[model samples]
Target: MSTSPTTLIAVPDSLDTGTPPAPAGRRWQPQATHWAALSIAGLLLSWWALTASGLIAPLFLPPPQAVLARFGELLAGSYMDATLPQHLLASLQRMLLALLAAVVVGIPLGIVIGVFPLARHLLDPVIEFYRPLPPLAYLPLIVIWFGIGEASKVLLIFLAILAPVLIATAHGVASVSPLRQQAALSLGASRWQLLRHVILPGALPEIITGVRIGLGAGWSTLVAAELIAATRGLGFMIQSAAQFLVTDVVVLGIIVIALVAFALELGLRRLQQRLTPWHGQPH
Candidate 1:
């Protein structure tokens, strides 16, 4: 009587048990582009509102429209004996040249200092001392040495850029994983091979970061450098415009500088991601 044989049930692995599946990795999230656009739009609206309401004088902060009109005029004609394109190109050339020189000299020097304690000890003091000094603080000496020419402007920018790159490179090289070095050496890799394969790649992200920082510094210093007897540049254009009370041109110049710096930084960041895609990735 007691019991019919108890029935045994087996569950299949593929059978749905009514629970939802866990999300595949992480879900894709919203991007920052929309927010950036919104912020920019908001700023423009605020600027327009302020100027339209007569709360802010156009002399100090021109409406965006006025700056836009001035920008077009400059593009179509000339300012300070050079067109907008020429001024923009001149500034770009100086920044690029300075960046190139900084990269060429700084990366190698930083690597040396990072690799050799003796070298680091010898140069660290000098670098640290000069790194904290502002560009304007030493511009006079640079001008005296290089004179009021392209050399001075380029050199001023170069010096402004050098410290960040050098520090970043040295830090990157020094921060390389010792385990990677050991593994490479165990595989009969020479010092150069180890550096080429393991160290440089590992250090690339930091180096790129340094370059980005250096570019920003150099860009900010552009106006100051160009102020040193520059006849044609965005800095000079802005300065000259300000002297003549052409607030529209000054505002336009400032906006142009910001846009250009943003573009350069965006490009460099892309390059960094391309070169070091594995950066910050989990093992």
Candidate 2:
């Protein structure tokens, strides 16, 4: 009888072992909110330390306590002919008006540009030209043409907001899958149906992102906008405080502006997440 040679088959480590493989160790990662809170705390601590150490003059950088006191005073009383709430309301109104105008005009124009090469060719140059210029550069021209009235102020912010919205919207529209458009067309989808069902939905995320960016631009331009002979607004308040060397009020205004902008961004981010949960996820 001839002996047969033993044949061996390799097995996976887990199978070769009687027990299952051990899981890899996972490092402990801090939550984003925790990190954010820690960072804010650290910043406040540093600010307090710098002020408390007397290294910086209160004339330049008011202590956090003085700023807090100023905030309370502003809330309870008036400054620059308007109370804090009044000033905030005025700023909010201008910003909202500009935002509405940008959305109404930018979305449609962006769609047209994205859809038609002719529109893009005619409009892209104008947009690119003005988009690069700072709002203050054309402030005098706007004031000259529209007068230093609410029109000029709102228009200034409107122009600041428009380019971002238009560009982002156009990008979003262009990014819509061509295959999806063709499929919709093959399914007897009308132009209106294609836009409503396919393009608009696909582009919404980018549109929101554009609006968020536009909002930041508008806020930055707010000081210049309010410089046009305005009696009330956060920007006006800040400028007024600066001129008088009311460092506390100026610091307070800066803090308020930062807080408001942060709040608006947070709100927009929440809205975006609610509207487009699938956005930014792996397909």
Candidate 3:
């Protein structure tokens, strides 16, 4: 009830007078997900437009609707000679078994390459020689050796994936910060202890990067390998479709491959996150 000429009284809180929290209005947060969606939609629209404008023949490039119909039919168990599900199952199985073998072999080799300079030097020439060779290059020999059976197909994918994983492992180990290694050594840690605890964790991010590369290689090799003596696979389905000019089946196969590959990548990313929480861009 007391009045002065615009007088004020204040109570002090325990908090210190410090810099204000950053304005929530930080400039330019990107709409990354939206941009990605737009890009995908644009590609699809281009594909549709080109197919519609007579720039491409329907036989070679079916419309999206036609491809959708074919994919539906495949899901409904309506296909020739072999059901679509059976072909998909065959392809997935071969890819998985080969991927498993690659992991088992590649992880150890990667550890060796990463940990031992001499080992890397010794393997460099051999790796360089084979890395560029298409897994298909061995198709004829694989046919002779494994005779169009599952073994041959699995081996092809295995060869394609193993190198990437091993090299990646080596790359990861080598990429670990030198200061980190020095610190461990200064703390009287042994080499094994350093690798087990520090180097491996630090390198895991790159190792995952390598695995993703290998997965792509593995997917491509699967299709190539299945093109050989396999009776049932998405590649086989596409091959069979081409004989009758059924572009729809081919499109459907490609879509399935893309979807499966995307799913695998997502799963692998999640697994990497769980296993190597420390190995990535800082939060």
Candidate 4:
């Protein structure tokens, strides 16, 4: 075939087949903190709007200014026979004590359950049976046996925290790879060495997760726990305020509790990132 003249077509180096890249200045992505702040701001604005528009009664939902004023009052003086700091301290002490106890007992029990079938058979049923029950359901029983003292209060929170830790530890331990365990054993590692070097490191993430869950449980149970004749606690303050319909004080107490819990959660998340940087990474 004799071509009179072959025509060559030139093509551009790049084609405009897809959307163009965004400019650096306009490409900003909202970080988790930004989203969180925005969400909080939105909620606060909604609250203010609702209150300012008089859509809700002040007794039901006090204005932000009233809550803030109540907070200042609490800081300057006492409410329900104790200052705000005193109530916070009392709550923190109980929470810390219960958390310490849960960590001490739950981790070892979980290890035993994970490593030994006999232990699992013996304890798993008991843990599963009670883990789902609300703290309030057992509060009266705890009071009856332990008395309506600090002991009962602490025990109530402790029980609420224990289950999650125990379950998480057991699950983490079980999830440790068999191959890794075998390799450790093949290197003439003792049981203790195998667990410390191979198992614990592998299981640390789950253990931390469990503790986080347990902390949430403990907080949820705090109000119920404080019901056991607590003279001082954020929960006690909330309860006392509710009884007298002190809406501002009640809101203030709730805000304080939520803020404290959020702070603790942030602390735990930092700890988790420090301890297990590889936890959520791809293999």
Candidate 5:
């Protein structure tokens, strides 16, 4: 068939190729934001209804409006002693520091151990012993080791965060296919060369996954650490508020932690997307 030149149209490479051929099957692509928004609305509505109906007392459950107002109050420096910014900074600093320490030490050790069966076998039992224990459960020992200052808090957070990173990194390394390793070997790649060029990149996405999850756990541990020995973190603020029956401040602190955690998760997701564009993307 002959086509006229005038009938032809140019399309950019970025343009969608329209509907792809079906594989005699179907899949659902759900938009997460809509569900998330609806969930928030439902929870708020339930809270409002329960409180307004007097079925839930204010002492036990404050209204959403009260919490929202308290959030604003916190931002405006209405709270005493420690300001909102100080608490946020303190928590963020601790979380970041501990997360860094965990990643720096854990990832290397995990990769090394995972790439070698003997190392894994030797260390697995020790790892299991430490991994199952809660950071709080080791509070006394950590205090004794590092004292009750920032070191203890950082150590506790690091312990809480370390296992996930190590586990994830090890799994990533172990999961590298034998085929890839064989191919690299056939290409005359040395042990160090294969590790540097093939294994690291393959394992990076999983390593990032570990880091993301570890950061979250580290943040949680930070709250616990602060609640116990902190003078300036959001957890300390919440603890103080609880003692004074200042539900508003307590709610504010909870919301702050939630907001920060949510923000960190979102940031990490964006980072993952940027780092691993191939992840969950169709060929």
Candidate 6:
């Protein structure tokens, strides 16, 4: 039989869509640096406007310049008995110690709670009861139990950080995809191997997030922790400054705390990205 008459249709080599999908709306998106700078500038301008205009007394809300001067003074010489570096070092030492202890104890306990319902049921009530209590509320008990020394301060901060880390880790571990676990099992993975290769890796992002949150809680509790008869800490310095109505110094202390906490958060974020490089990546 004769084949159907040969027929062909022309096809364009490339569709050549008009505009590239990428770099369209994204190009107009605000850069983080620009937005951060703008926000800082706006806050400073508003602060200056309010204070310089005499709408708010300098005593209550000192001008940014005054706070800056106070910061310089603190950095150059002693604010109270302890110099800026001394106070900062003391605070950092306590925070680091507390954070280390929390991480060590919290991660394993979290894993246990996440992996076993019995553990969760047994421990969750105790964690829940204590987690909501303000650090200040328990400060007295901590001081009485641990004594009003470095132990009390560190212990209080540790407790403040522990609950969040534990909860985060448990949630993260529990949220690990069952498919991933099954895949690991199908590959002849032992329980320990599955935990090491699949479960831990999958839970890392959430654990890191929980650590971030825990750090925040720890910082907020720092002042209270230092309230335990501290002679050298940012908290003590600020408290003394406030008692004496040294608002400039108080403001400077606040700024220092903010800057330090911001640095910590940035550091943790970088660490998390390094550890979980696959996170947030497009397929």
TM-score of each: 0.89, 0.89, 0.83, 0.90, 0.84, 0.88
Candidate 4 least-lDDT 10 residues? 2-11
Q: Name the top TM-score candidate.
A: 4
User: For residues 1-283, could you state the per-residue lDDT of candidate 2 as single tens digits?
Assistant: 1222223433366577766444433324578999999999999899989999999999988889988888888896999779998999899899999999999999999999877889999999999999999898999999899998998999999999999999999989988989999999999999999999999999999999999999999999999999999999999999998999998888788788889989999999999999999899975
- Candidates 1 and 5 compared: the better one by TM-score is 1
Residues 171-261, candidate 3, lDDT per residue (tens digit)? 8888888998999999998988998988878878877888888988998887788877778888888877888999889888888888898
Candidate 6's TM-score? 0.88
For model 6, the stretches where C-alpha displacement exceeds 4 angstroms are 1-29
For each of the candidates, the C-alpha root-mean-square deviation to the true structure, in angstroms, is: 8.9, 8.9, 8.8, 7.7, 8.1, 8.9
Model 4 global lDDT (CA atoms, 0 to 1): 0.90
Better of 2 and 3 by TM-score: 2
TM-score of 2: 0.89
The CA lDDT at 126 in model 5 is: 86
Model 5 accuracy (lDDT, Cα): 0.81
Give candidate 3 misplaced runs (Cα > 4 Å): 1-30, 52-55, 78-80, 277-283
Candidate 1 local lDDT, 1-283, one digit each (tens): 2222223433243246754433443334556998888899999999999999998888888888899888888896999899999999999999999999999999999899889999999999999898888889999998888899998999989988999999999999999999989999999999999889988888899999999999999998999899899989999999999999999998899989999999999999999989999888974
**lDDT, candidate 2, residue 267?**
98
- Per-residue lDDT tens digits for candidate 4, residues 21-96, read 4433454667899998999999999999999999899999999999998888888699989989999999999999
Candidate 3 structure, TM-score to reference: 0.83
Candidate 6: RMSD over Cα atoms? 8.9
* TM-score for candidate 4: 0.90
lDDT of each: 0.90, 0.90, 0.82, 0.90, 0.81, 0.89
lDDT of 1: 0.90
Off by over 4 Å in 5: 1-30, 78-80, 281-283
In model 3, how many backbone clashes occur?
0
Q: Pick the winner on TM-score between candidates 5 and 6.
A: 6
